[model samples]
Target: MDKHAQKIAADLLHLRGQVLSKGDPVALPLVSSSMFHLPGDPEGAAAYGRVDNPTWDALEHSLSVLEDAPCVAFPSGMAAISAALFATLKAGQTLLIPSDGYYVTRLLSDRFLSQFGVRVVQRPILGFADGGFDGIDVAFIESPSNPGLDLCDIHAIATAVRKAGGTTIVDNTTMTPFGQRPLDLGVDMVVASDTKAPGGHSDLLMGHVATRNTALRDAVLDWRKMSGAIPAPHAAWLLHRGLETLDVRFDRMCQSAAIIAPALADHPAITAIRYPGLATDPAHALAKRQMSRFGFLIGLTLDTKDRAEAFITGCRYLRPATSFGGLHSSAERRARWGDDVAGGFVRLSVGCEPVDQLLADLMTSLDRLMSK
Candidate 1:
């Protein structure tokens, strides 16, 4: 809450107005040219599409200011993470990943990075809560983790990892730069999928890595250049537009989830609830200490996969969608995606909908399930 402490709205407003010079469009101008004409020097910031773009630079600048670090944007969150891992680790190194975190990351580690000679170990997020980084070369954390919304002590783990001469990477997709700054918490690299709440709308796909270390930033940049995984100019611009209303969008969505998660938890059909925002939640205390907001996503488990499906299908207002953090509330059965959670597990992405209507939809849906 330093720079972002004050309303990030102002900075976003500045980005919209300043992306183009005086008498320019109020919105960030799209630089669509595949190649920019360089002077006789043959050296410039952006010579080709794979290299750079004005839209990307402006968006990165806005994101970096939030983290107070250097930032690199990529085509997707996975791309940014992939680049970060490839740029930092070499063959035959050890990597510690969260078993409760993003499954795709685990897939990349076990199915891809491992093939290249890296040792991949899947551990409970807090397996090293005490700074136990023995023989670990790299560690990744996703605070208020996905699907389950589990929280991890980032600062403690990062400190331990650094002491052990290992690198620390944090996926801040849930909390975002507004909700939390992982780099300030001692993490070496902060990665995010702007496709989620940051995009606000359900339309764009993008990601980025923010870091305080110049070497780490350059390495990630180099990997992105060589791999040719870059965000679309329009998508980047759309994301930046989404950023303008980020403070408002995130706050509204989180407010609704805060109300909705608790009521859903108390239902007889629900086996468990996992929203860090709730005081009754196990991660509430730690989240209060570490995160600016509890987050907009909620996790719940029904007695069976059938019941879970019934609940979602019965809802009047909530849409059944795979993604989270959109303008409309939606949910997906996590197990459908092959997550390790219970077959009845549901990941609800609360949106900027009227809270009363949302709560009623979920409650009524659950009531129908119980009756059946």
Candidate 2:
């Protein structure tokens, strides 16, 4: 592992839940109470679950440590995204978003935020760095953008946005904090869907927004409280547990992807392939400079939707699922979700399967598709 990854692994291993006394539980306690008892003064204590919870405090502390900034937890990724947008943007301000990023984000900006009189501009991932930030009040970026796997220079974009008196927020969901840290690169805020890699298991829905600016952090926190976007205590606890194993799980997934990306690149069945880990990938240089590790997602295209479906069905290990960053490997055709990709475009999320076994399974599936 690289030095950064090694350091993250060490830090994650030493993370411990908040300990109030000598006999406090070593594991993170799941305090599921909706309202805390306040016999005395409730001024400084948590009065209601909607405002705050001890479980969330512990989880957010751990997340803040990982992100190197303060964090606020949310019920889901969209909730976190919404909090960031609503907290920072005003009705007349302009918001810049990736045209090819997570489809839901675009939908939220176009269908919902637009109604609020927020002028939204859509730019492809490659255009972010060179695309002037003039008149933009906020910029939302996703490096190594979803499905397409394109990368942008986060530091450059952040610097430009800041110079223009704008806030920069990055969706670090694809590359979890273990793999990338946007705050260190000068981003104003970092939002992520913990449901992906950080949760590791596909069992819970959770997300968080992290930032070093206290005012921005409090703004997002207020949004969560007012909108009732807080995550359940049990889900928060599960996510905290999931963090313990994230370093190892992410390492294995990246390692497997490094092998799988190259092996599949030259296949006759694949018309195009995009994995930043591959030396031939267009975004490889930028990915190496800005990201600590190449992510697990691989974008590839076949000739037709039937060929893509056949490959997914023929594989023994890869399941057909929309979500990525789980224990089991999975894939999905992006066009089905209106991602503006070809009908045969596939987004493959590498999992923790044995490398050799996983590669063989992928090759077999491709070979079968070629045969048919």
Top candidate by lDDT = 2
lDDT of each: 0.86, 0.91
lDDT of 1 by residue, 60-85 (tens): 88887666788899989999899889
lDDT of candidate 2 over 1-372, digit per residue (tens): 677667756776566733447887788778989877889878988899899788899888779878878999998898999999999998999999999999999999999999999999999998876569999999999997987999999999999999999999999999998788999999999999999999989999999999999999999989988889889999999998998889899989999999999989989999999999889999989888988899899998999999999999889999899999998999999999899899999999999999999999999999988776
Query: Per-prediction TM-score, please?
Result: 0.96, 0.97
Model 1 misses residue 362 by how many Å?
A: 0.9
**TM-score, cand. 1:** 0.96
Q: After superposition, how far is residue 371 of candidate 2 from its true place, in Å?
A: 1.5
Q: What is the lDDT of residue 289 in candidate 2?
A: 92
For candidate 1, give the lDDT. Answer: 0.86
Candidate 1: minimum summed lDDT over ten consecutive residues — where? 1-10
* Stretches of candidate 2 exceeding 4 Å from the true structure: 17-21
> For residue 103, what is the lDDT in candidate 1?
91
